[model samples]
Target: MKRVFVTVGTTSFDELIERVTTPEATQALKARGYQHLVLQVGRGSILPDSDSCHELTLEVFRFKDSIAEDIKCADLVISHAGAGSCLETLGAGKPLLVVVNDQLMNNHQLELADQLYQDAHLLYCTPSTLIETLKMMDLSVLSPFLPGKPKNFADFLDKALGVQ
Candidate 1:
């Protein structure tokens, strides 16, 4: 069975789950009989309203130390579009689906998502488009876009300072 790991708001797991209509999405996976699904709701308690929908396990407020290991073991990762999560998912060479927080006032995430998407580097979704995006995601089409390693902070400072 294929496994999917989903990480969302720590304190808002219940709210986030409530917002997701995964039953429809899971239907596709269910048809294939792939039922190993896990939700790691960091910093958030599991809501009673969330339905398991097949072989699904819900963990609330998981230890911070275990997150990387959990991500490493999963076949696919579903997470928020925070820069940290994006970088980690990319570093692991895992396919990712990022759902940006709409409540964020400035809409910076939209810009970031657009840039990443334009570069063909990451998959992203807003609340309005999440279901459609999930249905259409082509994991094979994603590829790593690693920036060249910088020599050092001092080198960067020297260049910025115009010092020979």
Candidate 2:
């Protein structure tokens, strides 16, 4: 069964969870040939009612030590616009759609998501736009996010610190 994994990482984004589990969203996914929906709901107070959707199988959980396995198995990943979640999903070569949480104060998530979107690494939207994005997104256009060298950060740090 093709799966779409939705992750909020360790932070809460109940809006995203609630939006994706809606009947409309579920039907959109089903129409796209996704049979399974797995969600890591994070600290969201909302518990998904999987029984409402008969067309697709739903799996919901709060948190995990690692979501690598879920990413590996997903045909698509819908995630919050956190750097870790975004990078991990893209690194796994999964099509990623990042949902920017607009409620946060001075949100950097939007900036990151927008940059990645511009680079064709992933698609991004707000919770309000998620349904439309899901229905219309063409996953074929996303480019694989090739990871940069780990030493790049170290070199940058060294340069900033004026170390030779």
Model 2 residue pairs with clashes? none
Once fitted onto the true fold, the runs of candidate 1 whose alpha carbons sit more than 4 angstroms away are: 9-15, 19-21, 31-34, 43-51, 55-63, 107-110, 152-164
Candidate 2 segments whose C-alpha is farther than 4 A from its true place: 151-164
Q: For all the candidates, what are their Cα RMSDs to the real structure?
A: 3.7, 3.0
Instruction: Kindly provide the TM-score of model 1 when superposed on the true structure, using C-alpha atoms.
Output: 0.73
lDDT of 2 by residue, 71-117 (tens): 99999999988888888888888999998888874777667778999
lDDT against true structure, model 1: 0.64
Give the true-structure RMSD of model 1. 3.7
Rate residue 98 of model 2 by lDDT: 91
Question: Model 1: per-residue lDDT, tens digit, 115-146?
Answer: 77777787877766766776677777887868
